[model samples]
Target chain A: MSKIKVENLTKVFGKQKKRALQLLKEGQTKKDILEKTGCTVGVNQANFTVEEGEIFVIMGLSGSGKSTLVRMLNRLIDPTSGSVFIDSEDISKVNDDQLRQIRRKTISMVFQRFALFPHRTVLENTAYGLEVQGIPKNKREDRAMETLQMVGLKGYEHQLPSQLSGGMQQRVGLARALTNDPDILLMDEAFSALDPLIRKDMQDELIELQSAMQKTIVFITHDLDEALRIGDRIALMKDGVIVQIGTPEEILTDPANEYVERFVEDVDWSKVLQAENVMKRAEMITLDKDGPRVALNRMRETGLSSLFAVDRRNRLQGVLSADAAKQAIDEGKPLADLIERDIVKVRPDTLLNDIMVQMAETNHPVAVVSDDDRVRGVIVRGSVIGALTGKEVKTHD
Target chain B: MTESIPKLPLADVVEVIVSWLQANVGWLFDFISNLIEPTVAFFTAVLMFLPTLVTIVLIAALTWWLSSWRIALFTLIGLMLIANLGYWEESAQTTALVLTATVISIIIGVPIGILCGKNDTARNIITPILDFMQTMPAFVYLVPAVIFFSLGTVPGVIASVVFSMPPTIRLTNLGIRQVPEDLIEASDAFGSTSSQKLFKIQLPLAKTTIMAGINQTIMLALSMVVIASMIGARGLGEAVLTAVQRIEVGTGFEAGLAIVIIAIVLDRLTQNLGQGNGQHPRN
Candidate 1:
């Protein structure tokens, strides 16, 4: 089972819930339903399942019900209809005691506002979750201190939340949620309130933390760029509904609808889309096994200018141009003999925008290699611009 | 206008409730009176037992500890000046009365404030009663207080409690309500029990507002006790009443000045209790 499965989950705000829901079922828009029944539909049939140990981001502009959707997972706002299954247990149907246990032992939420208690010192606020569990003060403080240190707030434990900067206060908020040692972490736009540079740093830190902790995190954000930066998979929301759910690359390259398209349109593509996202499958002639005849034949048949030369293990060695292949064929030499070591190489995770500069001086396909020297894919200069501008590019002749 | 509304029996209804309470719940009133009368008297007795200089010096020291040296110096000079005017003992009795009434009000008020803060229905029910308690004339409470507890310091203490408690309740409720909604959500999101949320979050956050209210309560109690002297209560109020009754302007001026001195000291001390928390205010 998935870590979290929200099935046809919905929430309505106001006294006329039943009428509003009926209006919703009759296919009325959120505005239409609100106008008719005076009840706002906060979440409308939002459905998705998050796998274990993935950052599943729910993203939309304000009032899109992304916040409401996350709240219903923990029953912070009771669902007007449907079920939220965490580990195959229906959390939406749990008793108060059961829900409390789940909240304490299973899921912990970090909020957008940092929500650090102004009256409490960093240590006390961090230890609050454990304190509520009736743990002894010394033990809880020790645990709290450890989490605080993990969040890079070791020495400031005694200071109040108000004394800390916005970033430091959010670190305290993170430490508070982490002090409980929960399995599933819910981050409701946890970094959105920080300054841009600080937000990027926080996003990087969260990504690093996630790799080590491997907790399933449901992150919420209004910024599509933020969603693409850290999310393994994103659920794009619009008007109280999930418009699409896909990986960052898929969402950007092929949005599900006009709403998702608009959300991804102005996104800083350089910051999110990697080399692997835009790279084509690399065509290579085996370095030792294939000779100049084979290289020439393959290049001619594929109508390509050049091809990567790799070993039997598929480790990239060098490139062979069509001219160089002809040179080798005339000289009666092997593929390895004519291999050009001047070919540009990039890591698979390198940003596509970075590859454009790398592609400038080389006629050969830019090789995307792994850290282990494996050939992953190839990118052409024209394709880089094509990916950046969201269009198809003609191969460089 | 003559007979359209038939002259709603509001006054008579209130009179019947008071008489019924006096007739049927007289023993409960006596029990409360017995409980409260000696507490106020004991505080006064403690004040009277100390030498004038010792009490003044102790108060000055307390004021210094609670606030700044400037306020303490003022307190020192003011009490000395009052003593020089021959109202030291009466001022001590008045201070004791204000302290006793404030303690009772805080004890009764804070929990009700928390209840009102958490429960909408409780707040809705109690808000109108608070309005009635606050806006009703101060003299109106004295009549019921005298009818319930009869005369002397008991009725005076009870009347002062009625007159002085609304600010504490109102401010505490407002303070709790004013805590950022996200903070409350943060608490609830952590699965805190209601009591944990109150003690760990609400009360600490509400402390300054509550302290301000308590300061207001002390001032109201001080003023009400002076008014309470008409019902046979003791202290500087009695002295002032006596002076005013005989039209002794000089004596009345001295007593009134002493009351003002005490009010300043009490106000300064309580106000600093809230301000000294050293927390930078946050949203």
Candidate 2:
């Protein structure tokens, strides 16, 4: 369900005419000439897939190629080398008319400047995109009215853009983009120009709209918090490369490299990562309610050996040691009685780093999982260590 | 005498210029006469199509509708007096000639203003030429115009348009550029083509300033009647010029009053239009 795929994208601006002339006289290869007077790559061989109905964010600082990358997706600025596919159809080879057709039908872009026509009334500005696609005036106006209402700008349609405040003007811009019913909406810092209070309001509005519409959105923002808040998955970009792309929790706790780690390190992890992310899946373990003798035998028999003691309700109790179980059997006690239920556990959704810190401070080998006093799984010290050192370890059930 | 020289006060310099102008007042009378001659002839020529009485009433009614009723009432009174004062027909013709010339000047002026407003190259080319036209005296504008198009209402119109057209062009350019950048960008992002951007954003936003420019142009054109009449153009300017030559102060005052009335009516109409809706400053 990849909605758009961009591959081997590159953008180079301006040829060195003087250098070319000098090189021609010296009979140097074009490669040598290019090497000597190199073109600045705005986007260097970028590759990514935008999934269907997902909010994909491209995050970067100024001049980090994220803006250029987004622009290339819609062919706002053509790439020097590469292809962009919308639903697996190559759009780069399309003629101008076809390109505009694609833009009119499939993609709509909202600019940082909120580019609404000033002379036209707000209604006219909203109806403009439909008008461009040759929708008749009365019908187009009806469409515009619907869109204006959708963006919460219904009554002031006759007023010029100059008559409204900046935030209201941006709302008009949003209405203009949505009027066409484009499949993929590309917002290039669309809210960055507004005041912080208005920016937050617009963000909430976008999220609310997204919930109902579920249109595939490719949002570009420099603010990490905005990316984390709005993005289903964020691609952290730096110096023309995607350093990492992941869910907010993965990016925060297990950043792919130093650049991404620095960006995520300062984030309030407890608030950003949800319970669903850190929750251990229940399929990893089997229930065993038999006494200490059978539990110890099961632990010794299993390879990469460990035993998770659980009750009939499938709630995690604690890990039972083979030696402790043997002594428990010698004392003639039940397995649940011998099993340590005082075990500290993290919820599945807790941040991996937060769990590591908790385990370090408690000096425990394992932490039990619980859902309303019912144990789910044990987060062992080995799992925490493996996550930290980028090691993949088999989960103990 | 050289060693003990004293400087004159600033008030003395102002007095010098004022006294010099007053002393040469007779020359001013002759200059006004030379400007009104052709305006009278043009009025006489257009009179065959419509009677003087009908023209006067129509013009008075137009003034009333376009401007305030008070100005219209005053204009009607002035026309009735001009008709009775033996200089009525001549004054009517002069009025027709001046109005025609002013309309034509506006027709040509606004588009040039729009062009300069929209393009840097056009502005750069036209700006210096307008500078010379504005800086040069009224009589200076008449020289080449008369040489090329003979002495008549046409040459008078040409000279008047030259002298009055610069403010319109310059103001229109200023107004267009003064439109907020965000509005212009908004137009662009909405996929408005270049032509749509201009008519929709640039022109509408610049409307007040453009109207203000046109207002100034009209005022300048009205001021040109006396000067244009000197080059054989007719109107109230001719009556004023002839009266002054005969030392008929009452006659001159009557014609001058008529000119002032017409100017007031036209000025108020343009001023009202410029200051109407869409002028609310961005809060």
Candidate with the greatest DockQ versus the true structure: 1
Q: lDDT tens digits, residues A1-397, model 1?
A: 6999988899999999999888888889999988888898999988899999999999989999999999999988999998999999999888888888898889999999999988778999999889888999999999999999999999999898888999999999999999999989999999989999999899999999899999999999998878888999999888998889988878877788887888777877767667877788888988878887787788788888789999999998998888888888788777687788877888977876677777777677889999988998888766677767866522211
Please give the TM-score for the first chain of candidate 2: 0.69
Q: Say which candidate scores most in TM-score.
A: 1
DockQ of 2: 0.23
Candidate 2 wrongly placed segments (more than 4 Å)? A1-52, A63-103, A117-121, A154-168, A195-198, A237-250, A254-262, A276-397, B1-107, B180-182, B243-254, B279-283
The segments of candidate 1 whose C-alpha lies over 4 angstroms from its true place after superposition are: A281-306, A312-314, A321-338, A347-349, A360-364, A370-376, A393-397, B1-15, B278-283
**After superposition on all CA atoms, how large is the RMSD of candidate 1?**
3.1
Per-residue lDDT tens digits of candidate 2, residues B114-199?
78877899999999999999998888878656655557666677787788888878888899889886566445444556676687
Docking class of 2: incorrect
Task: Report the lDDT tens digits of candidate 1 across residue range B1-283.
Answer: 6867688899999999988988898899989988887898888888778898998899899999878999999999999999898887788778888998999999999989988998899999999999999899998888888888888888898999999999999999988898889988888888888888898888988999999999999999999866899998889999889998999999898999999999999999999988886444433
Q: Top model by lDDT, which number?
A: 1
* lDDT of each residue in A1-397, candidate 2, tens digit only: 6898988776655586555445534655435655877745566567889998899999988978888898888777787778999988888888766776777778888888887766578998888878866789999999999989998999999998888998999999888889989889999999999999999899999999999888999999998888988899999888666778887657766789988878875665444643334343332233354766566566656642446666677666666666667778789866666655555666655666566666766533444465664655556555554444434423222
The two-chain DockQ for each candidate, comma-separated, is 0.64, 0.23
